[model samples]
Target: MMDWRTKLLDPTPHARRDYASLATPVYRGSTVLFDDQKAVTDDWRQADNGYSYGLYGTPTALELAARIAGIEDARETFIVPGGQAAIALIYLSYCPAGSHALVPYSAYGPNKAMAEGLMRGLNVEVESYDPLIGAGISDLIRDNTTLIWCESPGSVTMEIQDVPAIVKAAHAREVSVALDNTYAAGVMFDAFAQGVDVSMQALTKFVGGHSDLLLGSVSARDDVAYAKLGPIYQQLGLAVSPDDCSLALRGLQTLAVRLDALEKATLQVARWLAEQSLVDTVLHPALNTCPGHEIWSRDFSGSTSVFSFIFSETVTAEQVVEFINALTIFKIGMSWGGVNSLAVVYPELERPGVDFGGRIVRLNIGLENPDDLVNDLRQSLGSI
Candidate 1:
């Protein structure tokens, strides 16, 4: 009874919606139809109830969020566009206008920039404190101190922080603690157990296991934190593509094995670099040279592949460039956590507490063979 056009135009069509697969299905759409008008009164911010809006999350996004929450051992998680966006979400949610926040001096460069720029513009006072301050941070706390930002093992310089001490101090003043656990990837460090109010990570790094995608996640400790952060996250309009979420979910499947390999490979390279004539000191939390090595040893269960080394004073910037450029396997790049090895030189590190008087280069050990990577480094050093 129906023509071809009528058949095509009919909105009431059915397909088997339930099918078992090895991976979570990616559901992409902007509009989610409600079965009844009463559902309109339901909150779209809560992803647990049912389908809401695409911007809030698709099934793929929610799947990734659930996995990240499980990894973090937190109650709820939110996925954002990138790692930087996660930081912004926390800052916006907690650090209200005219409030104060304390950030580690050795935090990621962009986080520092955010504090100095947007946070400042919002009439918030962002104070930079030494990562090793520990309980001494209590001195900086004020009546308006709303949040404390911490980054362990200083992403670039590898200065481990006294997280428990910082947390105790912050909680004493009723301030919430937000930690950047990207380096640990929620495995090495237990953020929730350590009393962190909010745990955030760049899924682009170890979670994605490849440099191809950029995604970030924020996990809230309990219902109160979740309720507070959810609205702000929605207002920020942070949305990640379903494809990126699916890729991140896939990356989670092998995260354990990949991280183990990277850890073993990185420590081997770091030890070798420490003994090299061109190297002054290696900045790795696993090594004694790092500022808070003991703290890291006590708090963290494992180390990551990314670490930095400082060249001896005798090694000039030009020589450093020559050495880095001479490398065959390691590509010159910025971000890490990919299958391919990466190397970068930070000529002028503005970190105050720590000092790397000479050229500083950060290496991200990938899935490459340790022997081959060492050989490449030896050859590069010979060239310099």
Candidate 2:
């Protein structure tokens, strides 16, 4: 004579199967049943051993996290809903109320917005430092400065920061360094080897490869930092869809190939853009014209498909819009790293420290033929 609850809580569906497949199976569940009541009391906080709860991680999430952790050379990894969530988690995990944090002037817009808007309301002091500060960042550090945020190859502007120098300076002051390594997709940059304490990235961009799914990961270099951040990660109740995790895992298998293809295709387009009379400067880090090109050349093993260029003074506002609108091959939209090419015009956010005199256009090179992309650009610029 069992109650209705006893029948409803059965875990018999997970029957053993003797089948194997190349792909990681998607595990989706909210409740995790145990053999005995005492087993329910076991520690399920970390994903090292087995399933805890769906919110903590399922096999799908753990597989993706392990893969990202391997590339990042980190002790553990946590998956979040999106890149911004990863950024927020790092900020909140380190900077308590009344603490101070330093953010780069060229950081992702949402990151800066969170710091200025929410973190400020919580009594945390958020300050912006120049991307070129490098080791000189020591001067900006204060007694209560608990965290320092770095975004190499600043979003849209594409200015590479001296990560090692900044990390060294931060470590000396007993401060933690967290980086938005989204542009590199954690593959191009060896964040941990370079002394980054916490490496956070948007898996939506490159790791997902396709623009279909959105995901993010935060990896810690050591046990101490992971221990400090783990509780906060759980408290935030951050969870990713198992379907998205499966897609990300699939995308990772081809990451190296896709990244290499993107690098080659983007450089061709960027170099061609630089030659245009209407183009003022190409902001690709691999190019000598970009700021911190030397640092990029030294630290980064390769480049990505995303970069920005400034239009020459001769180009008019209407002309800029006309050129972007006339492009037949490149789609006018936001977000990169998808198989489809995309472009967007940034009308002077007036981001601090860097200046784009004329209209700035950021191109996300796709898997299209470089010749076709160049032809599209030529026709558009010629029409203007």
| Candidate of highest TM-score | 1
In model 2, what lDDT does residue 289 have?
A: 88
Whole-model lDDT per candidate = 0.91, 0.90
TM-score of 1: 0.97
Which candidate's lDDT is highest?
A: 1
Q: What tens digits encode model 2's per-residue C-alpha lDDT throughout 1-384? A: 988899788667675787799999999888877767766743335576566577888888988999999998999999999999999899989999999999888889999999999899999999998898999999999999999999999988878999999999999999999999999999788999999999999999999989999899999999888887788888889988999999999999999999999999999999999998899999999999898999999999999989999898888767788889999999998898889898888876567654554389999999999999999999999898
Off by over 4 Å in 2: 1-10, 14-16, 42-44, 353-358
RMSD of each: 1.4, 2.1
Model 1 weakest 10-residue run by lDDT? 40-49
Residue lDDT tens for model 1, 171-279: 9999999999999998799999999999999999999998889999999999988988998987888978999999999999999999999999999999999999889
lDDT of 2: 0.90
101, model 2: CA deviation in Å?
Answer: 0.8
Instruction: Give the distance in Å from residue 56's predicted Cα in candidate 1 to where it truly belongs.
Output: 0.8
